[model samples]
Target: SQQGEEDPQALSIQEGENATMNCSYKTSINNLQWYRQNSGRGLVHLILIRSNEREKHSGRLRVTLDTSKKSSSLLITASRAADTASYFCATDDIYNQGGKLIFGQGTELSVKP
Candidate 1:
């Protein structure tokens, strides 16, 4: 079963603007992570927030998690053309032995220069 589901299926913005994306999950997770992918390449981990943590930040990326609501949000500040990519949220199944990450549908972002 799919765990994460992202909102705003696609986003378009100008360089320097802020971009925000959201994800909602269905089950209890050990940890939630956000990743970015450019074109058809591999995903690069942006940030990971544990179930005990509410918020986390790294560079221009900020993430907030609400376990009570089973949701998470990602914010990208000072967006640039290079920020154009597909953003996905993943959740680690608490019941899985291998700690597999179930990915979201993803939000495709287009930052125009």
Candidate 2:
């Protein structure tokens, strides 16, 4: 399966700081998306950038893609305790005739007050 994998498994940061995570995947994809899950909450779409794009940003969240290396990166600026949650990357092959998403193991983020 063409699934993305997040590194560091876990991360801890202070409030007002920045949090960064990395994701790598196998196979080619039409686009990649980042989602956030807050503890018991469901995953919420953070952002999505197509393969043709190099970088994208939403509010405090920034995402970058490098298709050549089959990797992507996420950066969250001005982190807060509320930012404590899990971050995951999902790969979608929109042009694969069928729309399917492959999710990663996710990185647990912890923000301190």
Candidate 3:
């Protein structure tokens, strides 16, 4: 069963603008991770936030997790056209064996130059 679902199915913005996406899940999770996929390519890991962590950042990417709310958000700062891609949130359910990740539907982001 799918654990996470992304919001705002799609988004578009100009270069240098920030992009924000959200994800909500159904159950307790060990960790939540964000990934980006370029057109016709595989997804790339962006960041991972543990259940105990409230927020994390790497480069221009910021991620926040609210376990109480079973939700998370990703923010990209000073976005570029190259940043255009589909973003997905994945969850590692605490009850699941083998630590499998259930991916969200994803949000398609388009950055116009």
> TM-score for all predictions?
0.96, 0.93, 0.95
lDDT of 2 at 17: 92
Tens digits of per-residue lDDT, candidate 1, 19-111, equal 999999998888999999999899998999999999999999999999999999999999999999999999986897247899999999999
Better of 1 and 3 by lDDT: 1
- Scored by CA lDDT, what does every candidate get? 0.94, 0.90, 0.93
Off by over 4 Å in 3: none
Give lDDT tens digits, candidate 3, residues 1-113: 67788998999999999999999999899899999999969989999999999999999999999999999999999999999999999998889734789999999999999
Worst 10 residues of 1 by lDDT: 92-101
Where in model 1 is the C-alpha error above 4 Å?
none
- Residue-wise C-alpha lDDT for candidate 2, range 61-108, written one tens digit per residue: 999999999999999999989889999999986556247889899999
User: Which candidate gets the maximum lDDT versus the true structure?
Assistant: 1
**How big is the positional error of residue 111 in model 3, measured in Å on the Cα after superposition?**
0.6
- Cα displacement (Å) at residue 7, model 3: 1.1
Task: By TM-score, rank the candidates, best first.
Answer: 1, 3, 2
Q: In model 2, which regions exceed 4 Å deviation?
A: 94-98
Candidate 1: residue 110 Cα off by (Å) = 0.5
